[model samples]
Target: MDAWLYNGKDADDVFGILGIRAEGSRSMNSRKLVVLDEYINLFNARYPSAATDSFIVLRDGFGGEADFARVLSMAKLRPESERMIANTSKYQGELFSKWMVEDMLEPKGVLSTVLEGGSYGTARSEDKLVVNHYNVFYKRRTREQ
Candidate 1:
């Protein structure tokens, strides 16, 4: 699972990162939906063997990034399916820790990802079995000048 961080401040920022731009009069949500659909379509074309539903989208309630991060880490997702999500929620401050990308369907054009948050699923050996769930957070990968 390759990790990418997008600066959610403007449409152009998103466009450059996702490789899609909105046409005349397209609302942000509409643009996002279009990107999501296109992304999924493109993704499906590459991985015919992986079932279609394996991909999931976690949209921010208000359409920003933080919410995107939250849903990205939800425990309900299947451990093996690849997920591609665009966070449209807002985030305050920065965050860090360990994240794992379990698989990469198409390593270049489009990527399908399996995320393991924080430490690997197991606790230190000889200790009681503890489910170490990694809390996912959005950290800025690029600092805009």
Candidate 2:
């Protein structure tokens, strides 16, 4: 199975720590919509047989409310950065949830289950290491009738 990770910040630094090829994208608004489309293309290209499975590791901030709030409380970020984070978190959470229910759960969809987990790493600044939580959504072909 192929695996990919998504985050708002530059992912190359933490890719080794997470053991996945991370792709950085806004994951909100219409700015980086193509990122998701690219991901779908990559998935299809990697799993051309239609019977293979893939994994997408998403930052918990993309869906976890409590975790996002906790990060906001602890991180010393600028006002604009804080607002952006909050907005993106809210938007991505709703979008992801909808995709999970309407798309992933449908027949022959390319998703099986979303599993939650956490990882420890330092930010780009490298000031200090912190726990970065995430969700790993497994994508696979649904059973054929």
Q: In TM-score terms, which candidate is top? A: 2
lDDT tens digits, residue span 44-112, model 2: 565565422111223442334333323322332322454456544554445345545564533123111
**Residues 1-145 of candidate 1: C-alpha lDDT, one tens digit per residue:** 0122222223233344553232211222344545655544554555555423212232223233222333333312322222222222211111112222222122111111322223332423211111212222211322221
Model 1: pairs clashing at backbone N, Cα or C within 3 Å: 1-101, 63-88, 64-88, 64-89, 65-89
- In model 1, the Cα lDDT at residue 36 comes to 51
Report the C-alpha displacement of residue 28, candidate 1, in angstroms. Answer: 6.6
Which candidate should be chosen as best, given lDDT against the real structure? 2
Q: Candidate 2: where are CA atoms >4 Å away?
A: 1-37, 48-56, 60-92, 95-145
- The true-versus-predicted C-alpha distance at residue 121 of model 2, in Å, is 28
- The parts of candidate 1 lying over 4 Å away from their true place are 1-16, 19-28, 50-55, 59-145
